[model samples]
Target: MTKPVRKRARETSGGQGRSRPEEPGEGGEEEAVTFIAEQVGALRKLAERHKLDVLHYLLGMTKLEADEHLRLRSKRKLS
Candidate 1:
């Protein structure tokens, strides 16, 4: 004769049931943060690979503005 098996109360009575730990929600926030970080990193790498034209345009505009400021300063010195 063999002895029958006993299940713990924490386990579900249904067949083929899955059990989870008794606590607060799982670390879903951490997983979301990790996923967002990976996406941002991929975007940064893509930006680096494709060299944004807008950035170059902005830099050119800044240089032009600085040249105008210098020209005005020189004109004021001559007056």
Candidate 2:
């Protein structure tokens, strides 16, 4: 079996963990919402083309549950 990977300790400032720098010209949060909406539209079309039943099931999930499950599946695939 493969062993689990460990995360390194994080850096902190003023007793709280420091955050990574943001991207330059990352448009306002609304841009992020728009981008995600576009991606979902594309995914839906592709799912229909491929007849992906699992993708249909995932999309039917409540928003929070769908996102959490997709994130977990993506991490597993990457590993």
Indicate which candidate wins on lDDT. 2
In TM-score terms, which candidate is top?
2
lDDT of 1 by residue, 36-79 (tens): 55555555556556796565455445545555665676698799
How good is model 2 by TM-score? 0.45
Cα TM-score per model: 0.36, 0.45
- How much RMSD separates candidate 1 from the native structure? 22.5
lDDT of 2: 0.62
Misplaced by over 4 Å in model 2 are: 1-9, 12-21, 60-79
Give per-residue CA lDDT, model 2, range 14-70, as digits (tens). 555544445897774445545565566677767768899788556534334545555
Clashing pairs in 2: none
